[model samples]
Target: MRSRHVSVWIDAPPDVVYAFAADPHELSRWAAGLAEGSLRPSADGWVADSPMGQVTVQFSPPNTFGVLDHVVRLPSGEEVDNPMRVVAAAPGAAQSEVVFTVRQRPGISDEDFDADIAAVTADLQTLRGILEGQ
Candidate 1:
């Protein structure tokens, strides 16, 4: 198993940042490389399907803070679950921090985890731009 965590500071309150980040419509704003995605009601949480594959929202704290779990199905019928979490900085500050954590499944190699982290980091930069009014 492998994991990566990255965080960035945003010049906004926690709630404002959290709300924007949680919106499905806003996902495309940050996830630029994504092919497509749409909202789907699921017992898991808020789910969506994108070019990267199927992602399921796991725990969403009220006020838009939470974690989302994703799984991609390979052509060979194999599946890997990637755990992702978003943690916000305390409220009332001029800037807030958005943290992303990713952990790949057991059989997955470090190379795969590193690649995913790179992709996710790119999106995070996009996300920061959108929130910071760039």
Candidate 2:
């Protein structure tokens, strides 16, 4: 399995950032690629929809952390199930670190992996802006 981790330090409090991350509706608010999504009550957790596709929550801890059991179907019709986790850490009262870790399945080529990385990175940057009130 291939993995990618991206993190950003924000000027908001941990709870503030955590709250934003925890809310499914807020995801589309910050995530540029997510055109629409909603939180559904399910055995796994919440499920969301974006322009790229849909993802279901496999694990979540209240308002502080969560993981999305994501499956991305590329334009070529190749589907990859990447499990991603979002974590929030507060080292200071006024600062927080938001981290996203993605574990990709085998069979994805280097070029595809690079493209996925770029897309995720861009989404993280957008998340940072929303959380920081920028």
Cα lDDT, all candidates = 0.63, 0.61
Number of the top TM-score candidate? 1
What does candidate 2's lDDT look like per residue over 1-134, in tens digits? 77888777777777676667666666667665543555455664445565556555443446334454344444455555544454445355677766666555577688877776777778878877887778
Model 2 Cα RMSD, 1 decimal = 4.2
Across 1-134, the per-residue lDDT of candidate 1 in tens digits comes to: 55677677777766677777766656666865342555566775545565656654433444443454445444344555545445546544657777776767677688877876787788878887888889
Instruction: Quote the positional error of residue 48 for candidate 2 in Å.
Output: 3.2
Over 4 Å off in model 2, which ranges?
A: 33-45, 52-54, 63-91
TM-scores for candidates 1 onward, in order: 0.69, 0.68
- Which ranges in model 1 have alpha carbons more than 4 Å from their true place? 32-35, 42-47, 54-91
Best by lDDT: 1
Give the TM-score (vs. native) of candidate 1. 0.69
